[model samples]
Target: MFTFPILAVHKVIARGEADAAANGGFRNPWYGTRPRQGEKPGLWLVGDEGIYIISNGELAGGQKPLVFYSDECHPKGDTDWWDYKHRHFGGDDGIEFIDADLLVPSFDRNFGITHPGIRLTENDISFSLITR
Candidate 1:
């Protein structure tokens, strides 16, 4: 499941663009453009069903990350994971490359982003259970 996260109220040592170098056009699915570096989470799950942003501590604390369903959960053409400043839509609206069905709710909510349909993958998702 994917999610469009806003800046949470917390203090963290964030790095540059979630990536050290903007060298290649591609980006890591887990880290994205500005992934949390160095600090290892208690658990992490990354897959084609998008990244599930949750946490062990938050789960224990009775909190859960917002899970947005998506088509291509895996990173494509350089997805940025650390871009919390703006909303992150699952797919692009113009073409028929990536998908956006289950992501409709989030699209309607964030900037009227146009989403078409949802995607189903056979693999189980791995992710962090984050706090809302």
Candidate 2:
């Protein structure tokens, strides 16, 4: 039996209805530009989509991951941070958000984006968001 490892990831800011979560994140960060060695994760606006997560190696490169989790940069929101994950990514976990559209890479890695009307649940792990 070959059991794939579960690489869970979450964003920093999660406001709006998502304010319930202390940070709306349960794991690491990965999004924006060329990911740093250990940079924190976050998205654009608050609760942009539904929060992003990638497991089963959904976002990985040639051992040169472009998305990684950091502990730094956890900005506080004026009225409570509520945003989605990064959109364009190049790693095992790419999470991003956009106001126009989310049909890009981030949405692929994550089943859905974070938004005032969106939310992340255990059911997210029910399906594989990565492409074959």
The candidate that achieves the highest lDDT relative to the unseen native structure: 1
Candidate 1 lDDT by residue in tens digits, 103-123: 323434565333222222344
Per-model lDDT: 0.28, 0.26
Candidate 2: worst-modelled 10 consecutive residues by lDDT: 1-10
TM-score of each predicted structure versus truth: 0.19, 0.16
Model 2 over residues 1-132: C-alpha lDDT tens digits?
A: 001112212322222113323333222333434443223232332222222322211222342212222211123322221222332121123233322122234544655433222232433312223322
How big is the positional error of residue 13 in model 2, measured in Å on the Cα after superposition? Answer: 22
* Predicted structure with the largest TM-score when compared to the true one: 1
Residue 88 accuracy (lDDT) in model 2: 18
Cα deviation of 80 in candidate 1 (Å)?
Answer: 27
List residue ranges in candidate 2 displaced over 4 A: 1-62, 68-102, 105-118, 125-132
